[model samples]
Target: MAHTTSHAAPFLSRAGILVLFLAAQMLALTAGAAPYLGPEDEPIRLNANVTVTGSDVRLGDLFSGHPDHEEKVVAAAPAPGQRMVLDTDWLTNLARTYGIEWHPADAYDRAIVYRSGRTVTPSEILAAFKDDLVTKGMPANTGLAPGAPLPTLTVPSEANPPFSVREAFFDPTTKNFSAVAEFTGPEGQSQFLQVRGTGFNTVTVPVLKSDVTRPQVITPDMIVSAEIPDGTLKHDIIVDAENLIGKSPITFLRAGQPVHDTEIARLNLVDVPVLRNDMNREDIIGENNVTWLTVDANTLPPDAVTTAPYLIGKSPRHIVAGGTPIRRGDVIAAQQEIMAVASRDLPLGEAFRSGDVDWVPVGEDSIGAGVIVSEADITGRVTTRPIRAGQPIRAIDVTRPTVIPKDKLVTMIYATPIMTLTVRGKALEDGAAAQTIRVANANSNKMVLAEVVDADTVRVVSQQSAMR
Candidate 1:
């Protein structure tokens, strides 16, 4: 019996030692894989902030604290304000291969917010949470971010759930926003997570794309729509390219500047006549020299001519350039006059008669404005100088018919207010009616100035009067 007991004791002792060694190995493995096997019984330590870089994220990025460095977990990058599961079966298999423990029941799913090409700091995230809380009239603070200490959040038991945002509302008058949230607890589900906070009302509207000076025409390329704070424009302000295109600007504006209803003017259509080429005075304006143009009324002069009659048959005051805008004051009607002109070219010393001249309307400037000769005064008169057809007859251009021939006897009269004396006088030169001539008194043979009143009749004029 002693031998049997001793042998059994050695076998049992060896067996117990082996079992203890196996148990110790199991404990060591569990301890090494403790981090991989998330703590489900304990509160979930949510890392308030998790930063993701590049276009993709991996599980190894979230579990960098693990002792194992061999991990190739990959997943699509999460957008800002998005939640995704970073841990998958492949990660679990990898952990298991490395002798790490993992529980499918553990809450390994994470909510991630990523920023690409933009800065979204931890303070900003915390402030967003605070604002949501403040919006709901709740005073709470969870100042945490990626590098900051992680906060522990004990999710309620299955019978109760944590609060979550469901919907949002905005108040334009106050520029505030409120979020509706839900919280399901064992007692009942409560969705009164009303979060109210200040925010901006964003709007997209067309604005000037560049600086425009006064009198500039608005074009489609001059405006673009951009997002900005709302309530900055009036009700009637122009915000579309169609509404602003082809419109004239009454004032100046800078790039990205807002426009007002009164800042732009509607184009007014007007038709005007324009010269096609440089024209001289009395140049007839025909289709070749003039054209009708339609243009903005504001661009034309106030008195721009609109009719063809205003331009045709009108003489320009000066040389008018081609395409020049026509105005009422730019032209005038040429002066006209009715006067006697030679019917045919008359040579010097040729006798003038009614048959040699004709009355016609000619340009006043074409002939001198001084002397006017009548047909009766010009009948049988001799031309003093050569005259051309249409040339106006002037008193100096021709001589009156001779009433008393040169060296002929004529009766001369010297009349006074109280006495009249008649005497015979000799004509010194040819004379006509109302023509002044030099005569010699036959009674005294003294030369004196006298007027031939009629054939062979002469009236003596005082020497003073004759000198005048």
Candidate 2:
């Protein structure tokens, strides 16, 4: 019985091996017939966003797990520059039909599709129309005026879209034109726009290349030419470059605009003498203080001094600022005598010395009648009022030094043709040298007129002369 059981076990093993080989063959046949589902662990995922430049949207644009049939077209793409959203229901139906192992995890599962595109600007369209009009017997220097505003267009993004103008018609007599503008995409889609405008003859006018301020001369290098409609030209508009060059703007001028004759003036420049530094009143203007500045004659004040000779050796009537043109009224001619001016500040009762004042040439019109002109007139004299430095001194500002004070005892001298006598007296009032004052005799208390000769002496006048 044990030998029989061992033989039966070997036969059972051979039968089991035959069944396993058949099952493997069946699995291979099933895999070849059905679509390839990737490894069991990795499931298909829905893309949240998609962008396409082609006419149709493929499966690969909405799912990421399948590659063998990803190029299969599922739906048409939206128009250029437009977008569309696919809901979860539409995505589930598409996945089941394509055998993609994907299911919406939530109701929010969706994909948004956008077709890339670019805008054709109005200016670009106008440029194409202009080129077409030129070939149709229009002038090369023609400016276009559109009857209606041109519309901007949207086309698929292409490196160089095929833009062209066709069916262009122009009437030379009427100066009117009409054309069809078209732009084509890479996928054979196209857009057409109609354009209508009038063409007019244009004239080239000189314009400033940059903003120019007043008093700045416009040179050839600062100007460029621009074309404008000839009908828009006015009588004041300057067309020739010769009129703009070597001219100065009256105010400010902007770039790329036509210049007007009234806005600019012909340069009639003259060099006028100006102060190199500020000059105070009565300050003399010398060659070193003068500078020459070139300016437009029209901007100068009337009777403005233009030469250095007119300003040199002159004093200002008032304070004049530097770097400004001097006018005839602004300055005075130094034709009067030399006058004494305080070299430094002088206090009241301070005696004047030679070094205390300076002799300077002064204008007669600027000085008062009592102004001192000689240093000798002020020397040894005391100031009655405080005097500032650089100010002219008047006769009333100083007086002779006081030599005697009131109520002081002084030696009084009485002299005749042969006899001379001296007496002690008291001064009745303060007296300066060469001034006469009344004195009282200290012994008899008699009053007598005396001339002060020194600090301690007074000469009594004769009775006959004192009575007069």
Candidate 3:
């Protein structure tokens, strides 16, 4: 073990200080007597670009100096990008001014040469870029978003180059900024780089007021709103305090932590049915085949069917597995019903009554479009063909209520303001009640438009038009 102690800097006596001053004065006089007779100093070897590390730099360190001799010549740190030469003549003049009695050796004419001593670090480049943004009206708190790229500072590793910010453009619409930087080396070589970053704005949002180690229900009083600078927040963050009420966290939320949408879900949920057994295509679902489950309403799809009535009578177009969600595509409408199933089956040419046909819902698309008959359209109508109880009603199964038969004799009445005349006529086309059709008058053998009144009777216009 070694002893260690602290001490102050050693102080020189007043007599010793005067002795040093007189010795320096005597050396200056001796140096003036001998014009070039002094210690031989080698030339200082400096690169084209040199970076000065400190303010007080000894001039003797740059060139060869004796180990025993003291050098009093000092120089201040040079500014960035300042270029200058330290040739033999310049060095000699600097030594003369400082009373430095030394000269460069005859064999070496050059002393020290310096071109540029600028050290542009990555941090310095970034600071300058930020300063440029501030001069152009950027906010003090403005910065790059998390994970944003750093400035592309590609200065030479071997030398420090002069750097300047050429342009810093910002676009408010896109919330992005770009910068162009130019770097010049000592030998006049130049380089440029373009850097970009996304701009973010600081905002205030509600945060949990206390730490929650386990998943707990959130309440309005448990949170407080605060302002903070954030660039990594998700897009669907919950910023309002009211939105936090009656919500349960999926994970633990620490105190003063900002609330996000993914962390919590609303406690209010709706109960919907899920299939318990596999449902085949066109199979009508029943109440007993499904089980109810509670799910968050926000998580449900917009077209999700929630009620049992919507699925009970509806038929599926595809097979639905058990435990799967019952959606729009899994079910078909229960509007298609068979007419004959409502009543006892009727034979061909039998008149159909409201009680004679059944309107039971079926799980088939056999009824073509536009041809589906409703109860009002089929009441008191006769079926043209044999009817099956479970078969869907078709257009060909029923005929129109024909009041007049084709090619049949009919009484055509011609009425006038004063009197009415009746004549025999033949029906050219089958006509229903109040239907207009062509009828040939038996007496004149001329076809005329007439309205069918009954099964065997028709009426013409006034006597003036009927006569023509």
Candidate 4:
């Protein structure tokens, strides 16, 4: 009716208005759509549906095991919030009229983790959400409308198992089955089972570990693999030998008296060659109850102890009375005073102690100088290596000397480089490989029955010949 102001429609404004109006209309429709009712025989919601989702999808699968599932409806996802709180006031009213109480499950205290497919009504969803919220550790009474989308609740997994074996058994005669089952429960859920065994093996294989490349597990079930004892051990001993106190009497003689072959018969002391059979290891060297004879008295100078064998102007006896006696070694003691009667040196002079000594003998000279004995003298074998004129007489220094008692028999010839040798022959009496046999100064006697050890050696000893 009048010149209206030229103004174009504001598209943005119009569109916004349209959107607002549409939203208002939708809200009004949704609001007026339905309400919680007390009407008998009525559904909580009319013709509406719901859905739910969360980290625990299996939780939904587990829901199939819930009770009265038919009466329950899976609704849409609730708005993002914790808890599956139910409006007890509203549900109670509905139950008063419909005779159905939507009380929580026995495990209601625990939050229900929603999987992608789990859904329920607003009230039910609220209750479930509240249950999920509270049980899932969320505060209670959290509000959630019908279209509220629920968050994915995380479900707990199993913890590391303890190092415990379930059962053990021992039996090998029967075929039987025995086992222990392993399982995992809900975060707070727990259970246990102990199984007694019957008809089991005394040895059985153990459970193999996954990470280990090698498998080594032995159990008590394999009887065929058991170890058996073969037998027990026993020991016995026989009388080999003992010390003899000379079945005859001992006659003492003057220290330096030389005995001709004729005088030996009249004398009591016998000059028997010391042999292995004659002396136990304990006798010469001494052990246990056997005492080491005083070499000091046994091999004193001709004038001191062995006057029976000393030769005048030839050699002085070199034996001791208070020292260990050797079978073929040298001896030292108070000759003039301190003196050494070595196998090669017959030292004569004063007294000797630890300090006045210059040289000493080391054992049988068997192995690289055996154990050396201090404050002790030697007495074994003494054969001269060489000799010189005016030299003090000694067993090891004499070259070609004759015994005064030439009438007495020479029983043995030691490692002699010359013809008068003690040869070891062939084996006899089964295992006997060697016997003592003496060779004449010039004869290579073949009639001699000597068992041989080495081709060129023999021991100078005879029991049968002596008895004959």
Q: Which candidate has the highest lDDT of all?
A: 2
lDDT tens digits, residues 235-268, model 4? 2110111111111112322222221222112113
| Per-candidate clashes, comma-separated | 5, 0, 4, 81
Give every collision pair in model 3: 341-358, 342-357, 342-358, 343-358
Q: What does candidate 3's lDDT look like per residue over 87-189, in tens digits? A: 6776677667644555666534553323234455555665667678878887755654423445433333334334778788666777687886787533336
Candidate 1, residues 147-187, lDDT tens digits: the string is 23323222223322344545654444554555554544222
Q: By descending lDDT, how would the candidates be arranged?
A: 2, 3, 1, 4
Best by TM-score: 2
Q: Write down the worst ten-residue block by lDDT for model 2.
A: 459-468
Off by over 4 Å in 3: 1-271, 280-287, 294-298, 306-321, 327-338, 341-393, 400-409, 414-424, 431-436, 440-456, 461-467
Give model 3 RMSD, 1 decimal.
Answer: 26.4
Off by over 4 Å in 1: 1-216, 219-270, 275-279, 283-291, 294-313, 318-322, 334-345, 358-377, 387-395, 402-409, 414-420, 425-430, 437-450, 460-468
Q: What is each predicted model's overall lDDT from 0 to 1? A: 0.63, 0.85, 0.66, 0.29
- What local lDDT score does residue 416 receive in model 1, on the 0 to 100 scale? 81
What's the CA error at residue 192 for candidate 2, in Å? 7.1
Per-candidate TM-scores read: 0.37, 0.45, 0.32, 0.15
Candidate 1 at residue 281, lDDT?
Answer: 62
lDDT of 4 at 151: 31
